[model samples]
Target chain A: MWEIARSNKRKSVIFVFLMALLLVLMGGVFGEHFAQSAETGLLVAFVIWVILSIIAYFQGRNVFLAVSGAHKIRKEDHPRLFNIVEEMTIASLLPAIPEIYIIDDPAPNAFAVGRKPDSAAVAVTSGLLNTLNRDELQGVIAHEIGHIINRDTLFMSMLGVMLGSIVILSEIARRSLFFGGGRRRTRTSSSGGGQIQVILMIAGLVLMLLAPILARLIYLAASRKREYLADASAAIFTRLPEGLASALEKISVSPIRLRKINQVTAPMYTINPLQNMKLAEDSLFSTHPSTLNRVRILRSMAGGSGYDAYDAAFRAVTGQTRAIIPPSALKTAHATVPSRSRRSDPKSDPGTDQTKQAPSAMGMAGAVLTAAVLMDAAAEPVTPAAKVRETTDAIWKSRGYRFIPCPCGAALKVPPDYRRTDIVCLRCGRKHPAASAS
Target chain B: MECPVCRESMIVIEYDDIELDYCVGCMGVWFDAGEIELMLGKSGIPFPSEALRFRVADTDARELRRPCPLCGKTMQKVCPEHGRVILDRCPAGEGIWFDAGEIREVIKESAGAAGDIVLGALRRYLGEALAEK
Candidate 1:
C-alpha cells in the first residue's frame, strides 16, 4: 500500500477546506432565500450537490472517453496489442477488463484512466505499436495495468472530471450572468430586498471565478501521492526493470511527444506526462517520478537480494514508502507478458544475417552501457539527443536517403539530418525533410 | 525506405504505397526523420488534435537528436507530433522512424490533435485568403 505523505495529506486537507469554502459561499448566497421562505432551500441545495457529484462519479468514464475521442478495440483489429493488454490484466488480476482504446497518432505513447478497472480505460497511440517490440510493448502494457489495479486511473479521472466540471460550470455561470443570472436577483429584491442580496450576488459571481482554482487544488492534493503508489505497483507487476526502462527510452526518443495530455489526466499513465521538465529537473513538480530515478531504483532492485534494496529504491524514488511492494509476495507474483511474435517480415528477417548485428535497441541499457563504459555518463544521452558523429550521417552519404523502416519493426524510417533540406524516398515515393526537420 | 535502426535496405508490407525502408533485418525504420510528416501529410492524428508530440515525451529538451539513422549523425528532430505536438524537432528535416506499430499509435494519439491542427490550419489558410480578398 502506498502511504500518503504528510505534505500531501496536508494539501488534501487544504483542498477539502477550499471545497468547504465554496459550499459555504454558496450557502450564503441562498441563505437569504431560505431565511424568508420556510422552504428548506439550503437542505435542497446540499442534496442537489451531493446527487450530481454522485451521478458524475458513475458516468465520468463515458465523458472522458468521448471527449478524448478514444475508440474501443477488439483483439481482432489488433491481436498483438489486445493480447498484451489481456496478459497484463490477468497478471494484475484486476476485477474488470479495462476498456482499451486506440488513437490514430504517430507518437509512441499510452495512458490509463477511468473510475475503476470496472470503469477503467487504457488508451495507446498507433505509434507506440510501431515503435516497441513484443517485450518492450508488454512492459508498457503491464505498467498501464498497474495503474488500473492500483486505482490511480480512477483517482485521476475523478479529479479530471471534478476539474472539468469546475471549468464548465464557471464558464456557464459567466455566460448566464452576462445574459443575466443577476436579472432574477434584481427582480426578486425589488420590493426591499436591498443591500444584502446585491452583496450575496456579488459574492456568488466571485465564487464562480474561483471554482476552477479550487477544483485544481483538490486535484493536486489527490494526485502527487497516488503517483508514488502506482510506480511501486508497476515495478511489482513487471519484474524486469529493463523493459520499462527501454520503453521510456524509446518514448523519450520519439519525435512526437505527448503534449495534449495534462495534469488532471497524467497520473493515470505508467510514466509522468509532463513535457516541460527535463528528466534531471523532474524531482520537483513532476507527478510521476523521473525515469532515471525509477530506473535507478529498478537497477538497485536487480542488484540486491534483500529487502534493503527495495526499501532504498522506493524511498529514493518516492521520497518515502507511501506505497510499497513487499519482496515476498511481490516476487511470487508472476508478472505476465505476451510471447514474442515469431512471424518474419522479409525485410527484417533476423536470420541468415551476419557481420552487422541488428541494433537490439533493447532497453536504455545498451545506451546506458555505451554511455557508462564507452563514453562518459554525461555524453551518453547526448548521442541519442542529436548531432553525435555516429551512424546517422553515414547511411545518407553512400546513397540518397530512403524512408525505410529498420529491422526493429519500428514502422518509420528517417534520412540523415545534415542533408535535411528535402528528401525523396526512392522506396516510398514520399518526399520529406532529411531527418524530420519540421 | 531505409532502416531506422541500422539503416539498411527495407520494404514496408503494410498500407498502400507506404513502403517504409525498414531494415528487413534489424526491424528498425529509416524515418529520414522528416519522412514521417511527408507520409502523414494532412490527415494526421486523433479526433481533431495534434498527437505525435503530445503522446511521447523527452524532457531533456534536445532538438539535436533528430538526425539520419544511417549517417549516425544528428538529424533535425521535428515533433512529428503534428504541428504544436512539438516533441524533439529534427532540423535536418527528412524522414522519420515509426518503430513497427508506432504508425497506428501516431494516428490514434493524433485523433483529437490532428482534427484540431487540420481545422486550425485550414481556418488560417482560408482566413489569409479572405484577407487577401
Candidate 2:
C-alpha cells in the first residue's frame, strides 16, 4: 500500500510539472503575442504559472468544495454517516478524523479532498446517504479514506487546478484567435528574428489548442490508476471487499446524476458522475475503470480482503501475469487462502473468474426485462433509506425477508420481536397473514 | 415559504447549503423552482423534460391538487413516471410541494436505476437458479 502511494506521488509530480510547463508555454505565447517580445513572454508565462500553482496549492480544495456546493455538516445532522466516517478513520489509521460535508443533490457520490490526511475532508451527496445501507456506506467511506491515506486527494486537486488553467488559457487564446489578437504586431520586413517570432506564434497557437486535451488525457490515466489503488485500500480497511463491490455496482447504475459535478471535479467522485453520458466503459477518456470490471475483481477475491488478494484477482481477471501491486509491497503482504477451499472447482480459479461472472444468454434477456420494468417504474426509489437499513442485517444473517404487501400500499413490517402469525399494517388497520419467523 | 397543504408557517431546515421549508402542521416541504433546478443541476444529471414545464394546457389533474402558496394558482399534480410519489408543482414556476412522506418515495425511485444495475448483473451472471440458491 505504501508502494502504491509512492508510485502515485512520483507519477503525479511528473504530471504536475508537465502541466506547469504547458501553463508557462501558454503564458509565454499570450505575453509574446501581446507584448511583441520573446524574452518578456517567457518571463511573464513563468510568473503566471507560479501564481496559479500557488493559488492551487493554497486554496484549491476550498474552491473545489464551494464549486460543488459542499457545506460542512454537524454530526447531529446525520449521526449514522458521521459514525461510519469515524470508523473508517480509525481503520485507515489516519492521524485525525477528517471533517465531513454534504452536497444536497440526490446523486449518490463521495470524494475526499485537502493536502493531507490530517487536514482532509470527505463530502457525500444526500442521495448517497439515502441510497446506500450502513455497510455499503462504510465501504464507500473506506474508499474515500483510502484516497486520503494514499494522498490521492491532494494530487487530484492540484491536477484539477492546473487543468482548469489550461482550459481557461486555451479559451482565451481561442477567443484571441477569433478576435485577431489586437492586430498582429508589424515588425521589420527582412529579419531572422521576425521569422523566429512567427514560428513561435504558430507553435504557441498549436500548444494552446492541444493543451487542454493533453492534460485531460493525462488526468484520466492518473485518476484510473489511483482509483484501483483506492479500491485495494478500501478492501483492506473494511476487510470486506464485497461491500465496496456492491456499493460500486449501485453507484455505477444509479440514474440520478450529481447536479454540481462537472468535468473538472468528475474524476474526484467515487464513480464518474458523467458516465451516464454512455461513453464506452473501457474508453481511454473514462476517468474510472468499468464498474462491472471493478465489481468482478472484488467479488473474485478468494479469501482475505488484503492488497495481495486484490492484486492477484486483478491480474487473473485482466489476463496479465504482471502484478498491479508493487513487488516491494508484496514481500510483506499476507497471503490468505479461504479455509474452505475446493482445488477441483473450476469456477474458483482466478484464471476463469471473468468467464464465470460474465452474463449468460438468458441473463441478457432478463436484463432487458428488468430494464423495461425499471423504465415503467421511472426513476422512483423502490426502497426507502430506512427500509434499506433494515435489509442490511441480512448481510450478516445471509437470509432474506419476505414483505407482505398490505392493501394500503405499505408493507407489513415484521419487527424482530413480532411473535404473531399475522402482522398488522400500521398505515391502514389491515391484518396480513405472515410466517411467524420473528 | 408556507405550506400550501396546511397554510401554516414553515420552519427552515438547513441540509448542507440547501435551506428547505418544512411545515410544522402538515410537515409538507416547499422547494423553490431555483432550489429544485439547483439541486437537479448540481447532481450533474439532466432533469426530466416533463418536470421542466410549470404549467401544461391540460389542467385536469389528480385529486391532491393544491394552490401554490406563492402564486395562489392551482398547482399541477405531477407524478414522475418513474416515481410513485405525486408532487404538486406550481403553475407559475414558483416551486413544488412535497407531502410529508412523498420525498422519501421519490428518493427511493431515484435509486431504481442503481437497483436495476445490481440486480441485472446478478441475474445475468448467476442465472435465476444459482442466484436463488
Candidate 3:
C-alpha cells in the first residue's frame, strides 16, 4: 500500500509537469500567432493556472460539496454515520476524523475531499445512508478514508480543476476562431515566415482541440487506479473485503442520480456518481472502472484482507496485475485468509449477504448489547445507554424500517422482529397491518 | 413554507441547492414548482423525451383536499408517475406536497434502465436479503 501511494505521488508529479508543458506550449503558440507576443500567451496561461490552483487549493472541496448540495453535519445530527466514520478513522490511524456531511439527494453515492487527512470531509447522500447497512456503510467510508490516507484527493481535485480550465479555454479559443477573430491576421501574414507561423498556428489550434481530451484520458486512467488502491486500502483497514464488495454492488446498482455531478468531479466518488450517464464500462472517457469488475476483484479475495490477497484476487479477476498494488506492498502483507462466512444462514440467501454484522436489525441489537457491556465495565457513561439505543433506532429508521405515525401524534416504530401481521401502535393503541406500515 | 394540511411551519431542508419545505408535524414535504424536478434529476433518470406520452387518469381518490401552502388556493391532484404515487400540486403551479416516504417509494419503483440495473445487481449480489418479501 505504501508502494502504491509512493507511485501515485510520483505519477502525479509527472502529470503536473506534463499539464504545465501543454499549457505553456499552447499559450506560447496563441500569443505568438494571434497576439504577436509569446510572452502574453505564456502569461495568460500562467495566470489561469495560478488562479485555478488557488481555487483548488483553498475552496475545491467546498465548491464540489456545494455543487452536490451537501451540508455540514454535527455528530448529533447523525450518530450512526458519525460512529462509522469514527471507527474507520481510528482503524486507519488518521490524525483527525474527517468532517461529515449529507446530501439530501436520494442517490446512493459518497465522496471524500480535502488537501490533507486532517482537513478532509466525507459526504454521503441521504439515499446511501438509507440503503446501505452498517458494514456496507463502513466499507464505503473506509474507502473514502483510503483516498485521504493515500493523499489522492489533492491530486484528483487538482486534476479536475486543471482539466476543467483546459476545456473552458479550448471552448473560448474555438469560439473566437469560429467567429473569424483570427481572419485579419491570417490575411495579412502572406510572407514566407508568415506561412510557417500560420502552419504552427494551425498545429496549435489542432492541439487545443485535442489537449483537453488527452488530459481527460490521463485523468480517468489515474482515477481508475486510485479507485482500486482505495478498495485495497478499505479491505486492508476493515479486514472485510465482502463488506466493500457488497457495497460496491449496491452503489453501482442504485439508479439514484446525483443532481449536480459532472465529468470533472465524478472521479472523486466511491463509484462514479455519474455511472448512470451511460458511459461504457471500459470507455476511454469513463471516470471509474466498471463497478462490476471492481465487485469481482473484491469477491475473489478469499485469502486474506491483505494487499497480497487483494493483488491475487485482482490478478485473477482482471488478468493483468502490473498496474495496481505493487510487489513491495504484497511482501509486507499478512497471510490470514478472511472468513467468507461470518454469519449464520449463508446458503439460503444468494443476493445480499446477511452476515449478522452487516447492519441488519439483529446485528444492530448485538452491537448495542456489546457497547452497553463495555460501557458498564468502563464505569464512564459518556453516552447513556438509552441515548445509544435511541440513536441506533434512528439509524434503523433512516434505513427504511417502517415508522407508524399514530393519531396521538407520537411516531411509533414497528420493531423489525414483530411477527404478527397486525399490531396496535404502542403509543396510541391504533391497530394497523404490518404490510401497510412499510 | 407551511404545511397546508397542518398549517404548521415547515423546515427548510436543502438537497443540493433545491430547498424543500418539510412539515415536522405531518411529516410531509413540499417541493415548490421545479423543486421536485430538481430532486428527480439526482435520480439520473432522463426526463420524458418521447413523442407520445402516457398519462394516468386522475381518480380523485384522495378526498382530503389541502389548499396550496404558497398561495392558499385549492391544489390539483397529480399522479406524477402513473396513478400509484399521488401528490397534491398547486393549481397555480407553485409546488407539490408529498407525505413522508413517498419520495422513497417513487425512487424505489421508478422504471428505467438504470433502476433495473441496480435492482438486478442488488438481487444478484445480495440475493434474498435485498428482496423485502
Candidate 4:
C-alpha cells in the first residue's frame, strides 16, 4: 500500500513536472514562431492570455460562489453549525478552519475547494444538513476534513488554475494565428516569414490537443490517491468506520443528487457527485473512486457487518444514485409524507419527532423569511406562542389554505372536524413526508 | 471507551444502522478523537422530530479517570474544543466512548432547532432552483 502511494505520488510529481516543461517548451516554440514571422496579431493575443490567467486566479472562487448562489455564514447566524465546525477544527489539528457556506440546493452533497487547509472553503447543500443524524453527519464531516488534511482541495483548485492558464494561452495563440489579433494590427507579413507561420500553425494544433489532455492528467494525478487518503482519515477521525460506511449508504440512497458538481469540481468530493455512473465504466476519465469499492474499504475498517457489508448489497440498492435531494421541503414537517398517510397520525410514529423539528422550525421561519425575501417585508421571529397560533389559525382560515405557518412549513389542510387528525401537508417529495408529526 | 461521566461500560448503539457509542449508565457520548470533526464536516438529512427533545447532562460528576473502552488503558478527560465538550478518546486512532445521551444530544442540537430554519430556507431556494428530485 505504501509503495503504491509512493509510486503514484512520484508519477504525479513527474507528470506535473513534464507538463510544466511542455508548456514552457511549447511557449518558447510558439514565441519563436510569432516573433520570427512578425505577426502583430499573434503577439497581442499571447499577451492577453497571460493577463487573463492572472486575473482569473484571484477571483475564481468569488465568481463560482456568486454564479452558484452560495451564501456565506458567520458563526453567530447559525451557532449550532458553527459550533460543530469549531469542535471539528480543534480535533483535526488543522492550521485553519475553513469558512462555511451553504448552497441553497436540496442535494445532500458538499465539496471543499481552495489551495490548502488555510485557504479552503467547504460548502454544503441545505439538503445535506437536513438529512443525516449527528453521528452520520460527523462521519461525513470527517470525510471532508480528510480531503482538506490530505491537501486534495488545494490540489484541485490549483489544477483548475493551471488548466485554465494553459487553455487561455493555447487559445490566444490559436486564434491569433487564424484571426490576426484581438485588436487592430498589421495583417500581412513578408514572404520570408512563411516558414515561421507553418511552425506557428503546427504548435497551435498541438496546444489544442494538449489542453484537454493536460486537464485530465492533472485530475488523474490530483484525484486518485487523495480520495483514499480522505476515506482513511475519516475512519481515523471517527475511529468508527461504520459511521462513514453508513453515511455512504444513506447518501447513496438519498433523493437529492449533487447538482453543483461539474466536470471541473467532480473529482474533489468523497463520492463522485455525478450520479447514474458506474466507476468501472467512468473511471477512465473520472477522479472519484467507485462507491462499491469505497464502501468495501470502509466496511473492512469498520469491523462490523451491515447492509453495506458487501458490494452486492450496495449495488443492488443503489439504483440511479445521482438524484439531488431538495432543501426547500426539508424543513417542512409535512415533508415526512409517508408518516402522514399512515393509518394513524404521522406524529404517532416514533420517527416523526426528528422528522418534524427541522422542517417546521424552518416552516415558521421560512414563511416569515419568504414574506420578507419575496415581498420585501421585514420581519423577526414571533416570540409569543400566540403569534404563532394566530398565524397558524389565520393560515387555516384563509381561503385556498395557501400558506402554512406550522413549524414544519408544509402547506396543509385540516378538516374542521379532523383538526384533531392534524391534516398535514402533502410530502414535498424530498425526504419522507409530513414535517408536522413532531 | 469508558464513559467519562460514569466510568462505566460503554455500549455502541447503532441507530438507523449508524454506529454511535453510548454510556451504559449516564447516557452521554464521547465521540472518538476526531468524530466531532467528521460529523460537523459532512452535511446530513433532517433530524427526526423524536430525536430533538434529548438534552445533554453530565451524568456523573464524581469521577475523572476512566478505563479506555477500546485499549483498556486508563484515560483522562481531554478538552477537544477546549472545555466545551471534553473527550475520552484514545490518544491513538482507536475508537472513543459516549455517555448515553451525548451522541443523541449532539445530533439533536445540531440537527434540530434553528439550524433547520436556515437549512429550510436554503433547501427551498436550492430545491426549487434545481427542481431535479
Computed on C-alphas against the true complex, the DockQ of each candidate is 0.02, 0.04, 0.05, 0.01
TM-scores for all candidates? 0.49, 0.63, 0.66, 0.47
Best by lDDT: 3
Q: Write the per-residue lDDT of candidate 2 for residues B38-100, one digit (tens) a residue.
A: 554445545444433333423455556689988889888776665555678887878888776
Candidate 1 lDDT (Cα, whole model)? 0.50
Which regions of candidate 4 deviate over 4 angstroms?
A1-15, A32-61, A74-80, A116-119, A181-200, A253-261, A275-282, A302-438, B1-133
Please say which candidate is ahead in TM-score: 1 or 4. 1
**What does candidate 2's lDDT look like per residue over A297-393, in tens digits?**
8888875576678888998876769877766555543223121112233344433332333346434322211101111121223468343332232
Please give, for residues A1-438, the per-residue lDDT of candidate 1 as tens digits: 222222233454565566545554544444443243224434544555566567657776675556555667665446566777776676566767777786555567787776656667788766676667665676787777766665666556544554655565456456766775655765677667677767766766677777667666566555654554454455444444556667777776666756456666565555555555435534434556566666666555543322234456667765765434443323331221111112232342223332133336433322111101111122211322122112222223223334434233223344333223544333233544445531
Error of 3 at A379 (Å): 22
Q: Model 4 Cα displacement at A166 (Å)?
A: 1.8
**Considering summed lDDT, which 10 consecutive residues are worst modelled in model 2 chain A?**
A367-376
How much does each candidate deviate from the true structure in C-alpha RMSD? Answer: 18.7, 15.9, 13.9, 27.0
Winner of 1 and 2 under DockQ: 2
lDDT, candidate 4, B35-117, per-residue tens: 44343333354334442222222556344766676676766544323123444555464655544334333332455464444
Highest-scoring model, TM-score: 3
**What's the ranking of the predictions by TM-score, best on top?**
3, 2, 1, 4
Question: 1 or 2: which has the higher lDDT?
Answer: 2
- What would the per-residue lDDT of candidate 4 be over residues A1-438, giving only the tens digit for each residue? 022233334545765665555556556655555544434434444455456445445665666666555676665444445555665566566678878776766666666665556776776656666555455566677778767766656445655555555666667667666775422223434467656666665765676667657657665656765665566555544544566667777776676676655766667555677746543432555676666666666665323221122222224334434211122222332112211111222333433343445545664423211100112222332344323333232322321222223333433332222212222222222222222431
Interface RMSD of candidate 1, in Å, is 14.3
